[model samples]
Target: MSSRIREQLLSLLLEQGDAFTSGEEISRRLQCSRTAIWKQIEELRKEGYQVEARPKKGYRLVHRPDRVAPEELKPHLRSQRFGWSIQYHSQVLSTQLIAHDWARKGANEGSLVLTEEQTKGKGRMDRAWHSPPHSGIWMSLILRPTITLAQAPQLTLMAAVALTRALRRETGLDIRIKWPNDLLINGRKFCGILTETRGEQDQVQYVVLGMGINVNTLEDFLPDELMKVATSLAIEGGRTYHRVTLIASILQSLEEFYDAYLKQGFEPVRILWEEYAETIGREVRTETSQGTIAGMAVGLDPSGALLIRHQDHLQPVYSADID
Candidate 1:
């Protein structure tokens, strides 16, 4: 079955929520025959959609599984490119590992690899990312943008702004960005971004932008030590959201910001980042390779470096574990 048909069928059933749509009506609306509609409905059943079918009444969507697979996400995606093609896994060591392979193999921009569980997921500074099965969004998006190597780090900050906008818009939670790549609410973390790029001397070849979001994870799923610093949207929002819907929103937001960045440069994205940033105008203690640097967090330089004011000197930090 064509993916487009699957998307259209699911969308139709969802739009008519709690109402049974007839087979004849569905066929007419989709411009397909009754046989085709029935076949597609069967496919949906296999994909975990609880569709009710009667003799005359066509189908009613009873339940939609919270899966970020193509069937679930593509139906909600309105972006022209992002999420147009997707790869899903039930379990993987890391989405980043597969994404890197696909990037080298010439995966198109916006090709996404997502999974229900990641056994060995990682965050910045080599810390382990706790990814529970079916409780969060763990994925890597492949992007082949027309940007230089020096500007690749900006992708991390750009993604921070994009996801912040998406989460705040979708869930209405008060989320803020933590410098280069994390999102927090009420001084606790719910999302992290890890951007990896392969490039020539001055130009980028491809970027595998990885995102790990804690969405529906309940408090019991968290480790005892993580309860203080880690949290999920479900916990903060006091309810669960459809992971597929959130994924679609994030993809749309990323694509929008990405297009703007390509045309308008980092100035616009930087402004948005500052608006959502929680690290600015605060004292920061960052651990760099050279040594620990304690300074007052001020702003970001044009290239997306965190500018710190230490006594009389302004320092730009490219990579660090900031507090």
Candidate 2:
């Protein structure tokens, strides 16, 4: 209810595109109290929107900030389905987990679950993701595709490709995909992608594409252990960037690449992914449940599995803990 009201208020103000709006007029139109309208106005201000209030004039949206509200991001978003519907939480245990639950309850395809801060956020292989308050992009995308379970793994690579393209356009960061899903800049970890799916034996019900990118994380906020290994957009780009814009770009690219993948197969995205991939043709080591393997990263199979060229053998690694 509040979400609808907030969106409606934004739309009204955007349509008006004037200096100010009267409380009486807005309250009557929204079917809410003037106090309720004022509170929502305050909420928008808190999210970086510059809402100017006057005793006689009521409220005026002076500037639309670059936070990731559905309405604020709507004009910038270019996706047909991805992020068309969004659920934003100020703080949550995990957006990915919440997205999974929402998907189970029949959320639409490309529904976004996002949070400013994640308390129990996780990464690939149950690793704890460091998400400081309002410092990064901690979000999950719910994608319900008409594909077999085998094709699910390809989505992570697709996301990496999409995210890389966005970074290139937005920040112009020299980013690369580190094999399976990690995004790197200047040989350091800048982003991570984790793909989890829930479905039946031969069908995929919904897949959660969880992506975490260090946008503006401060050195003080990071754990002492990760300060050396992790890098943020602020660190790499040397400037502060709006997370909302980056997210909108990512969703747009994801939608484009996804549609192409569905029609033409992974060949196109595979080419793009390989071009930006840093791990391919590099000497690396990865840890699997079985053991550690030292090999040369050849490329990805059609299923998005890593093909490692070990001594006297070529192997397809299903899952690996990249080192």
Per-prediction TM-score, please? 0.91, 0.88
Clashing residue pairs in candidate 2 (N, C-alpha, C atoms within 3 angstroms): none
**In lDDT terms, how accurate is model 2?**
0.86
Model 1 scores a C-alpha lDDT of 0.90
lDDT of 2 by residue, 206-309 (tens): 89999999998876777889877888888888898988888889999999988888899988888889899998888888887767778888887777788888
Candidate 2 lDDT score at position 299 = 83
Q: For residues 112-161, could you state the per-residue lDDT of candidate 1 as single tens digits?
A: 99999999999986789999899999999999988999899999999999
Residue 53 lDDT (model 1): 91
Error of 1 at 38 (Å): 4.8
Report the number of the highest-TM-score candidate: 1
Cα lDDT, all candidates: 0.90, 0.86
Residue 279 lDDT in candidate 1: 95
Off by over 4 Å in 2: 11-39, 42-50, 55-58, 62-66, 288-292
